[model samples]
Target: MAPSFGIMTAPSQVDYADVLRVWREADTVPEIEHAWLFDHLMPIFGDPAGPTYEGWTLLSALAAHTRRLRLGVMVTSNRFRPPALLAKIATTVDIVSGGRLDFGIGVGSRPSHPLARREYDAHGLPFHDAAYAVAGLAEACTLIRRLWTEDEPFDFHGTQHRLTGAFGSPKPVQRPHPPILIGGRSSATLRVAAEHADIWNIPGGDIDDVTRRSALLDRYCKDIGRDPANLTRSIHLPVSYDRPGDTRAAIREAIDAGFRHLVLGLPAPYPADVARWTADELIGPSA
Candidate 1:
């Protein structure tokens, strides 16, 4: 099957609810499955001091409003919330949305992003080294998945911390939990994805970069005795095409490189012409 082209709307510039609605309608128009939030506490490149909505809250509201659209954060920072609490919230939203959820997670360390750095400073979150954050994220992913699937309370010892009598309630609506989508390019991140991800997302990479990363991920899966094919591969690309052919080439390249899903980030309030064009033909192939 050809890859599905979903949208990830940045919540920094528009009313977040309106942003979700645009993609919710897009899902129906284009027969797409997933719609995402970029998971930033503040506007990144635009109006760094302006307001930005929380992804978890926005997702909950969207869950109530959307019926079939699978919702997710393109890549959520693990620093924003505790694993157990995040797990519970995700489960609740999954139930509310009738199981349309794709939980994508990643490390929170961002020394290069001024917006995230500002948030960390204001919120008193320690700015740890990249490796430290990725390691913590791995542990969080393990703990969150266990919380979603474990039937009995058990003591869980993570590298960074431990949980006692750990078990989650109302297990996620999707058995074994909603597909965990892990995103990043680093080796450590890929290993965690290989270990815990149902979908390993490659964020903003061209064909060569994506193929290389996919190969690296396969190596990690191999080291763990995992068949890389078991974990679906996806690409999330920032896109604005004056010509449909440009986006079409990108989509085809991703598919040919072995991605099963392609998430295209659009300009805020994705222009109707662009949306219709994508629905008509800009994706991987025949629509």
Candidate 2:
């Protein structure tokens, strides 16, 4: 199958108008199937003082503005918000987008990434160890799904989270909740994705490494009695305006590696007509 293509506009170092403009244009282009924003409370690249918008918040605004594109945060940090609250926020976005929402989530940024780590300190959010974060993410997926699908209010107690009388009202526009896309390359995360995610996404760069990770994910899925084929393979490839050929080559490699869902990451200070340019220069040629 031809891989589905999407664009990811990181909500940092760019004005809302800039992101909106690209999304609106992408909406009209049939070639662009979805759009995304990164989940970051602060800038992860360029200047640390640069403006950065909240992912879900900006996603809601973009969801309301665009008519056709399926939109979401590429992967929300599970640590940033309570599972129940995140479920509600995701439900709201799904409703706002008229069911055109893909719920992407992950265990959050690794503490080793200095730029991403500072956001936790600035926000007064606790930074747990890898084990705790991965375990919490697993628990979160279970709790959020129940909230989205259960008919009655229920309580949940887990290793990382505790909820009393938790229930999602005005459930998401997508029946049985939006498609869950879990992103990460760790084995632990791949285990979580095997059990919970409808799609699994990873950053693109080293095709060999990503291919190995995909094979690992297949093993994880099989171990859990789930068919690995049921989970869609997605990859995020950075777009290069000066080197469109490089981007196309990466796309082709990802597709050949069994990734059928492609998200092209556009750097900030976006060029005018970027979405169309993506379709014409990158996605079109790759296709």
Candidate 3:
């Protein structure tokens, strides 16, 4: 598959509907298997006041608009929704998208606005601790997967969640469950991905940095005696092509280094620069 490439439409200051249209057009681009959209309440990188779209709402719209192209939240915050509710949401999205849903979830990064009990600074809540957060995420994943895959009534008891005699109806279209993707580069994150994630999405970093982090994940998977092949390695890269043929070389370079997915963040202004960048750097003949 030559390392499938996709676009991560960072809704930072861009028009959501317009980006959705571009993504829908990308379905005809032949090389794109998935079109990833980030789930964040605020801009983590750019100016804080910039416009940012809510992730799931955007994805739900994308599900309605896109066909053939897989749709996903690059990584959603497990802290934002109850595990049982999230399970149903993923299942619903999968059914609606005809099995094209990929659920990428993570512990919330930075304290969420109108913050609740799960964030770093909320009173009476534990601060950001890797061990505790990983445990919580593992519990959530276990519960969510059981809710989706188990036939008989299921009960889950863990450090963070407990469920009894509850079941989710209309199981996801994907057998067993929709693919679970965990995003992060920390050791705990790697361990979680090795244990529970079908895909690991790392932040954009240099090849050597990515390789090193990936080796850590591979080692963790090996220690657990889980075949690394079962885990997919994906990277989110910020790419721009000012001239013809620039992005292709970078694409080839990433593929050579074992990146299975490359998500290029198109610059803002939905109809102008983003469209041109998508055509030239993402889906163009040179790309």
The lDDT for every candidate, in the order shown, is 0.80, 0.93, 0.76
Candidate 2 lDDT trough over 10 residues, lowest sum = 155-164
The prediction achieving the highest lDDT against the true structure is 2
Tens digits of per-residue lDDT for model 2, 70-184 = 9989899998998889999999999999999999999999988979999999999999999999999999999999999999989887987888889889999888789999999
Off by over 4 Å in 1: 284-287
Q: How displaced is residue 49 in candidate 2, in Å?
A: 0.7
Query: How far in Å is the alpha carbon of 202 misplaced in model 3?
Result: 0.6
What does candidate 2 score in Cα RMSD to the true structure? 0.7
Provide the clashing-pair count of each candidate structure.
Answer: 0, 0, 0
Score residue 145 of candidate 3 by CA lDDT.
Answer: 92
What tens digits encode model 1's per-residue C-alpha lDDT throughout 1-75? Answer: 556768777777787656765766765664566788877777787777776888878888888887777889878
Winner on lDDT between 2 and 3 is 2
Model 3 regions lying over 4 Å from their true place: 110-127, 243-249, 271-287
* Whole-structure CA lDDT of model 3: 0.76
